[model samples]
Target: MSKLIWKALLASPAILGAAVVAASPASAQQVSSTTVPSVSALEATGDGSTLSNLDQLNQYGREGRARRANSAEQVTSVSQLSDVQPTDWAFQALQSLVERYGCIAGYPDGTYKGNRAMTRYEFAAGLNACLDRIQELLVTNVADYATKADLEVLKKLQDMFKTELAALRGRVDTLEGRISYLEKTQFSTTTKLTGEAIMMLAGATSANLDDLGDAFSGNNGDDNQVVFQNRVRLNFNTSFSGKDLLITRLQVGNSKGFNGVAGETVLTNQVFGDTGNQFTLDTLQYQFPIGEKGRGYLMANAGVWDDISNTLNPYFEDYDGGRGSLSTFSQRSPIYRLGGGAGIGVKYDFSDNWQLSAGYLAGEAANPRSGDGVGEGGLFDGQFSAMAQLTYTNDAKTFGLGLTYNYSYFGEGEFGFDNAGFVSGFTGTLAANVLPQQDAVTSNSVGLQGYYQFSPKVALTGFVGYTGVDSKGGSFDDADIWYYALGLALPDLGKEGNLGGIFVGAQPYLTNIDGDDVKTDIPLQVEVFYKYAVNDWISITPGVIWQVNPNQDNDNDDVVIGTLRTTFVF
Candidate 1:
C-alpha cells in the first residue's frame, strides 16, 4: 500500500514538498549571511534565455549546499531548545521530528524562531535539506521506513496540489523571461545604491541661567523652542572582486545638533550635524581580504574609529540614530572618536572565537599650507590616533569581551578628543582664554567593554573607558578623564519590531589635572528610549536625555532634552 501511494505521489508534476517550496525565488527570502557568497559573486550573467531563471535557483542551491556542509551537528531532541517549553502546542510534533526523524534544526544560539515566516523558495530549500537527512537516516536503518499506507497518503496529497504546481511552473517560466530582460538592461553590474533619510523634532530645557557670573554664562538664551531638522545620506557600494568592497557616501544635515545652545556640547544623536546643513562627501573607504582569515581597510577621506574598531558597545552603537541608543555618548566610548582622513586598518581572526584589530587615523591628513597636510605635518607629523584591540567570544555570540588601547597625539589647536574634555575645549574661550598655551598633547586611553545576552529578549551591556593626557612642549597641565555606562536592553518589546533601553553613565569628565582633584558637581548622564519599527523601511523613536552637570559645574542648570525621530531606509 505504501509502495502504491509513493507511486501515485511520484507521478504528480511535483511532489507535495516541491509544490510548497518551489513557487518563489530563494532571493526573496532571508538567509543566514554566513551561508551565502557575496552579492558580487551572484550577479547576473548577461544570458537572455530560459536558463536565466535558473540562475536564481542555482544561487539558492549553493546556499543550501553551504548550509548542509556546515550542519555537522544533528539535533536529537527538541529539549535542546532552552527557550521552548512543553506547553507549546507543537512541542510534541517538534520533539518527534527531532528525536524520531532528525529533520529539524535550531540555530547555534539555541533559537528556533518558529514564528518567522518562510517563502516557497526557503521552504523548498528546507525541505530539500530534510530530504537529504532522511536519505542518510534510511541508509543507516533500512528496516525503519514510512509504511505503504503513509506513502499512499503522500501520493494523494501530491496529486491534490497538481494544479497549483502547474500554475507555479508557468509563473516560473515567465519569471525566467523577466530575469533575462533585467540582466540585459540593469545598470552598473558591480555597484548598488542605498539611501536613508531622517526627520527629527527636538527641544532642550535648562533652568540655572539666572544665577551664573562666569563670562560664558547666560550666553545661551532662555528660548526653550522646538526645532526641526532633516538628514539625508546616499551610499554607493561597489565591488570588483567578490571579497572586496569600495564605499562612497554622501551626506547632508541641517541640525544645530549638539553645539550647545549656550557654548556647550550637549547630548545629541550621531546623525545630527553642526555644519549648517552643507552637503559633504562623508566617507571613502575600501575593505579587502588580506588572507583567508585576515582583512584590511583604507580610508581615503572622511573616516573614524567607528569605521574600523570592534566597538563592544553593541546596544548603543547606531551612528545612524535609526537604531540603538540615541545619544552620541551612549553609542560607544569617546576614546574611539578618532578624527578621519587617509588611514589604514587591519584585522585578523586567529580562530572562530577570537580576533585582533589595529588601526591609525589622522584628523588632518590633508592641509598643505605649512604646519599640516598628508605630507609634512600629516599622517605621521600631525594629529593622529593609533589603536589596537583584542576580542573573545563563543560560537553562539551570546557573550563577548573586548579590551582596547589607544594612543593619541594632537598639535596646537587640534584638540579633537571627541569632547571627552568637557571644559577643556571651552577654556580657550573663557575669561582668561590664553590660546591653550599652543602645546602638543599626548593621550593614552584604555577601554574594556562587554555584553551578555541572558536570552533573545534581554541583555546587559556596558563599558569603562579612561584616558590620561599629558601636555608636552608647552606651558599646559596634564588631565585625566573617565567615562562609563551600564545599560539594560529589551528587544522586541511590546511588538516584534520594537526595542526599549535605559542606561545611566558618566560622560567624559575630568577627574584630575595638574595634581589638583577636579570637583565634579553633576557628572552623570541618564537616558531612556524606545524604538518602534513602523515597517520594514520606517521606524519611530522617542528618547530622553538628562545631564546632571552638562559642563561639570554646579552653577549650570541640569539639562533636559527630548526628541521624536523618524527614520526611513531603502
Candidate 2:
C-alpha cells in the first residue's frame, strides 16, 4: 500500500483511540457536550491494537447508528477527547464547509488555534473526516432504496454516485500523472538539443529601382539601398509548480547598415563579403509570474530591441497581421533605437481588459563598434532609456499606447551624424560644415498609434510620430521629422490560405534650417502584399512598393520598387 494510505490507516480511530489524551479542563469541558462514540466500539479487538480496516470501521459506525435509529437506544456512554486547536485558515475553511455541506460541527469550544500549524498527517485526517461526512450526507439526501419498486431508483442513484466518484478519481489521477511526468520529462526540446533555432527576419529595401530619370536636383543625390535584418531567438521555459512558469529567451540578429531614412546606405565597402550584415543580441531575458492570475510579471532581457516610429511604416516591416502595423510603427519610432543593452521590466494586468508595463534599458542606442570600422559604440554611454506602455483589449479589438524617451550625454567623443547632403561616397562642403559636434547632438522623440476593427475581416490602422535632435551649438536646427500613415487589412484570402493587404502613407516635414528655401514637401508610399502559407512551419511573401516623392525629390516625380521574399518559422 502507498505511504499515504498506510498513514491514513494508522491515524484511524480504530487503531488510535478516540480519547488518547486530554487538553485543559476548560477546553475538554467545552467539547464534552458532543456525543462521540468510544474508540473501543469501533475497534476489531478488545486491546484496540488489532484495528479494523477502513470499510470495517465504516460499517461498524453505520450499524451502531442504524441500531439506535431502529430501537431508539438512549444513554450511550460518551467518550471525551481533547480539543485540538486548528490554524485560522483551516478552521475557517472547516466552518465554511460545515455550513455549506451541513456537516456535524464541533462543540462551542473556543480553541480555534488561528496560528497553530497542522502537519500533513493531521491535514489528511481532517480532510478524510470531511469526505466521510459528505458521503453520509449523500446517502441520506438520496431517496430510500430498500424495496423492490425502488430498485430502479437505487440503480440510478448508484450510477450517479459512480460517475461523481469517477470524476473525483480522475482529478486525483491527473495530479499524480502530472507529478510523475515532470519527474521523468527532460527540460530541453529536440530543436534545442540539436541547436536548431527560430528567428524573426525583417528588413526594408528602399532602392531607386525606377528613378524616373531625374538624378540631379539637390546636393544629396537619390538615396537608395537594400537592407536585410534578422533576429534569431531561442527560449527555454520550466515550471516548479504547474501554476508558475519561468521563461528565458536568447536573441541575436544582424542588420546591414540600418539608418532611419529610406535607402540610406552606410559602409559602402563590404569588406566581410556577404557577411557585412549588422550583428546584435536583440533580446536575452527571463520572465516569471508572481500572482495567481499571472496579473503580475517580472522580466529581464539583455540585448537590442526595435524602437522607432509610433505607427507602421514601410521603413519598418516586421510582424504579420494582428496589430502588425502597430507593432512595427512602435519599433521604428524615433524615440527608440535598437542596440545592445540590459533591461528590467514589470507588467501588471489590472483586469481582463487593462494592462500596464514599464521598463528601462541601460546601454547604447546604436550598434556597437566592430573591427570593420563601419560599426561604432559608446554613443549613449552612461545613459539609459525609459519607456511605459498601456494596453486595453477586448474580444473584438485591442488598443495600445506607449511613450519612450532617451537622453545621451557625450562628453568628448566622435558620435555618428547623418549629413543630409552626403551621397554616393561624396560629402559636400556644406554637409561637412553642418556635421554635428559631439557635445551638441542630443535626441528625443514621441509617437502614438492605434488600431480599430470594423468587422471580422477588415480593420483600420494609423499612427503619427515626431522626433527632434538638439545640437547644443551646432548648425542643425534640432531636426524634427513627422510621419502619418493609414492602411486597410483583409484577414483571410479565399481558400488559398493566404493574407494580403494594401496601405497608403505620407510623411511631411517642417525644418527651421532652410526656412522658405525648403517647402513642406509630402512623400507618399503605396504597398500591396500577398503571403502564402507553404506549410505549418514556412511562409512566403511577394509584394510591390512605390514611392511618389522618392528621396523627397518633389521635382523628380515618383519611383517604384518590388520584392519577393520567403520565411521559415518553427
Best by lDDT: 1
Provide the lDDT at 2 for model 2. Answer: 45
Candidate 1 residue lDDT tens string, 1-570: 122322332233233233223322352232122222211222222233435444443443332222222333545355654333456533443455446556666553333432122122332222233344444544464555433322233333333323322233434457668988989997657898988888888887754544332422324455566888788888999988888999998888886544332323333433335446677887899999988999999998866676776777666677535567777667777667644467899999999989999888876676544563122365567777788989998799989888989888776645544422212332111111111435667788899988898899898889888877787865546766777889888889998878899988876666554422234443577889999999888989899988776555556577788988888988
lDDT (Cα, 0-100) at 501 in candidate 2: 68
Q: TM-score of every model?
A: 0.63, 0.49
**Tens digits of per-residue lDDT for model 2, 71-119:** 2222211111012224444344544454454432322222111111212
The model with the greatest TM-score is: 1
TM-score of 2: 0.49
Residue 474 displacement in candidate 1 (angstroms)? 3.7
lDDT of each: 0.60, 0.38
lDDT of 2: 0.38
For model 2, the stretches where C-alpha displacement exceeds 4 angstroms are: 1-3, 6-232, 238-281, 290-340, 350-354, 365-381, 392-395, 398-440, 473-475, 495-497, 507-510, 514-520, 555-559
Candidate 1 clash pair list: 1-148, 2-148, 5-152, 9-155, 367-373
Which window of ten consecutive residues has the lowest lDDT sum in model 2?
420-429
